[model samples]
Target: MEQLKKLDKIKVAIADDLDFFRKVLVDIFEEEEEFIVSGVYKNGQELIKNIFAIKPDIILTDFKMPDGDGLYVIEKINEMKYNIPVILISSYAKQDNEGILECLEKGAVDIIEKPTEQSFKASFDLLKTSLLKKIRYIYNNCVVLNQVKTVESKTTDYIAIGASTGGTKAIETIMRDVKRLSKTTIFISQHMPARYTTAFAQRLNSICSNGITEAINGEKIKSGHCYIAPGNFNLIFAGDHIELTDASKQIVSPGIDIMFQSFVSEAEKTCGILLTGMGSDGATGLKKLHDHGAITVVQDERSSVVYGMPKSAIEIFIVDYILPLNLIAGFINSISQ
Candidate 1:
């Protein structure tokens, strides 16, 4: 019971031109003690007019509103420099639509796939759960942004990051803000099953500043590209290039230790960022990098999903900087630059 109450309650406003959908979203919030429905606007214009008065924590708005739409609301927020976080809902989220991309560029933080086929009652009920997770991530990202101010690091040959559960959102937030330095590359190890790597890369590439893709076997790992380790294999460097191969053990999933160990063979001055996650998959790998004079950073315990990895790394005296997920980008820039 105590743990259940730890979730933060957030104020929210729903904006959609559809009358039934607007009330449904509002009802979803009213049903949860963890969320407060501050206002319901039928169109983007009404939302823009009353946002100042409501001052909600998050905005859940549909893209088909009158007067304005999701894109318009996003543009206005950016033009006005509003600090609020907005989550855009559209049926196109499931499709390969550019609307989601445009929303991100305009300042909306997360995009959700709204069920267009479902009736208002069913869709709103489902949204209650999904919105909770998205809003938590958004609020947490907001918390980190307040702490870390710098956007990009100084120029370096490479940057490497390692993480597990909760890493997806963390990595996306970091990548969105970091401006690419010329001739720099990034390597990442996110412990996902073999089935998810391609979609992960495609989805990640949408938000990242640099090109993002799954590591192909024998690929000549080079600077300026972001390499995501292919799932179900050990991603390591055999000769200063990424080599995707099966782990020596019966363990089928791709691991992180070999990835960091091999990369540190030559790129000793690189920056290593370990983010919010569970387990110890990345601790050994990060420590290996730290031993080679790399600038090592581990997410602080307070902001982590599970502190296992960072905790182990810190105990070994390998992590040079202890920061929250947001502070990591700034710390990287300060050191690399």
Candidate 2:
């Protein structure tokens, strides 16, 4: 344990209503030297009250709590303009749950299941491993948004974008800049749960001039419009129309690689843009697209919320341009024009 303490430690804050669960979390982290429990709260209200003072790198919060819920904590953190990321913990996470979806839309980064079936030791072991992995990923790869360059005019036949983790904000930034685009059909596959995709599509449509909508089966691809892959389904193109499939049939929900691969045969004039995300979902598909003559763009490390996806694509040596978040839109515009 002493030798383990020599490694870098990740600061963690935990909030749960049940005393037993709270104590369980504290004990679990105590055994792991790589994690230091900055604070543990019995409720969301307590966590919010002491959050700034604790200044934890990330928060692990229960979905439902007696005095204010996880959503309340997230809202409070936003109100205070804190950069901390929150992970919602629940017994079960249904993709259709409005509260879960709302928490995600409101800015909670990810969700995990609270172990309830196993013995204390078993549960602690599993939770600690999963929790530590997420903490390390968020700590190491979280990107800060820098000022973006002004976009220049450009036009393309189709644009396909894949993102996860910090995707919502990154997509918003890109769409805001590219709203002036004409004659381009944009397809977005963001790693999100089911009901939240509709909310996200509506949110994006409201902010940007682009006609953004959640994708439905058998819908024809249209120019100057943006289609978002529904959370429970994988968005793929069949000839000239969009198709939604049960994501369980694929590797990842709204799989970026699946969508990118589907575009390979039909992509005559295409550009594949892989944005900030947590995994290497789009690397293989992006490589296929790049080999097929599509202009491939990736978000640079400085602007990526998590560099995993972009880093994987870069490692494969398939990327055409590696640009910062701010410059991606302008670069795309310049190339497409």
Candidate 3:
């Protein structure tokens, strides 16, 4: 008797109002061998009602639906403490930037545009690629990170921070809690758009005691000041000065690795902090800093929105301290003092 191969499939649930579009989504997932369509709902209300029974690994939901919307579903999932990653699919993504941002804030892991009848083929092709990438990304980064390395406390003159995804809220919390530094110069490299970085800096400055501003080219670094790396650009150290470089070609803009690597020569005086972010962007650079005797700290898994960056650094055995979100600011203050 010939034995058949059994596949472990990733269960996917969908919630969309339009019948034709819902059918199209089901058809798309049905063609993939690794994916199993677990349940389909016409609106957020139906999905929420049966979510516990379906137990989907991932969810794809339309942004606007009667009875309940994608944002409502995300809020409900958070309230229920369900860890399933949800992705928002919207037809008006091109024009609704604010709405998309709000969805991200509400707990959607990622977002993509829904295919319209006119551009079905082309739009669906890109959507399929992005959708598959996000799904794999969520599962691929499910690395367990509970280990903590003991490190002696050391005073630091320079501080570098890197973050992405849920970084804005994390950064705000840190900056607000941190008392003004007397001699430390902080550098922040957050993944953001060019137009928003200035506004972000302004927001941080209003809440924090330290002077926070977007870094400029060939500017001398000052103590008790925080420099935010401009979006779509890389911030690098140039002997106590800062320089900005165009980073359009790079996979992750405002490359945290570049900023972290620049401190290699002055490692003993620098403190590298990698916060919550996706992928392994800053892990290697933090490793280099650690090898050279620099203080390296990573946000612990439980406190992180996405533990990809910290997990990567931890896996490499280069992290010095793993603290929760609330303790990071105090840790930095203690190190500087």
Candidate 4:
């Protein structure tokens, strides 16, 4: 892994309505040398009003607040085109899978289970550790938004996308922007927890023209649809059908490498795309795809949330194109047409 970039303390702005919880977080951050509490707001409305002026490197906001909520802050930040990463600290993360998916879909980098009134005292240590770890992880993997490039057309029967970390937004962008895909089937290998995949697939299905669903074992593959590997399990291409594998032993569940490698036999009809992610799981498999006559694309560093997966594939000199997020969908469409 690449070393963390040398920089000053990571500036964090926090939004929460509760005084005690806010102070607890402030105190915790104050004790850590890595973070500096740049601003504190009682609600998302206040945060939005001063966020640009404060220019925090990260936003840690509560899901529920008096004037505005975490969703409000996320929508505002995105509307303003700021690149700052947002993490939703929410009690709802434990029970509301759909709500958590909404945050992820709206562009939040990650979500943490906030301590409730009952769990606060006992969960303090765990919460503190989680906060620090998530902050550092986001700081290290943040991406600089980039412009898109046009693609030359080619025919493809299958499209495989691999992503992790900030992949929810990345995948959403492609699915939302890509023109109707009637000629090819799409497959996605996203690193996510087991509980969220169904909701994620449903979220994608709502916005994408192509139907989306969690891949099922023994299901026959077909065009005009998109299938996402179920979280914690591997989805493999088995000629005319799909196969689900136990991914407990793999380093990352729904391992991108396993999915990409499984398509070698169909390489001539496949387009392998490696998007923003935190690890190198898809690199070797993408190389195999490239060598086996598949079209290979990697999200460029400027457009990647982590750049780790794409960088690994690029390093192996296997990719045919390095694209920004904006162009990927159009490029896929170009090939499909």
The numbered model that scores best in lDDT is 4
For every model shown, what is its TM-score relative to the native structure? Answer: 0.54, 0.54, 0.56, 0.56
Which sequence of candidate numbers ranks them by lDDT, best first? 4, 3, 2, 1
Among all windows of 10 consecutive residues in model 2, the one with the lowest summed lDDT is 144-153
lDDT of 1 by residue, 125-209 (tens): 6676787887876655353222222232334577888888788777777776566655667888887787887898888898777
In order, the Cα lDDT scores of the candidates are: 0.70, 0.78, 0.82, 0.83
Clashing residue pairs, candidate 1? Answer: 153-333, 154-337, 184-224
Tens-place lDDT per residue, model 3, 236-312, is 98877999999978888789999999999989999999999999989999999988978888887866999999999
Weakest 10 consecutive residues of candidate 3 by summed lDDT: 142-151
Q: 79-114, model 4: which lDDT tens digit per residue?
A: 765556788998777787887788777678778888
For model 2, the superposed segments whose C-alpha errors exceed 4 Å read 1-155, 249-251, 335-337
Residue 172 deviation, candidate 3, in Å? Answer: 0.7
The CA lDDT at 235 in model 2 is 91
lDDT of 2 by residue, 1-337 (tens): 0011112676789999878888887887798777889998888998988976876767899998789889999899767645467889987576438889898876687788887745656677677788778767765543211111112123458889999989999999878766455677889999988879999999999988778999989988777789999998989978779888889665567999989998888555778899999879999999898888777778878668899999999899746566556545555445442
Model 4 lDDT on a 0 to 1 scale: 0.83
Question: What is the alpha-carbon lDDT for the whole of candidate 1?
Answer: 0.70
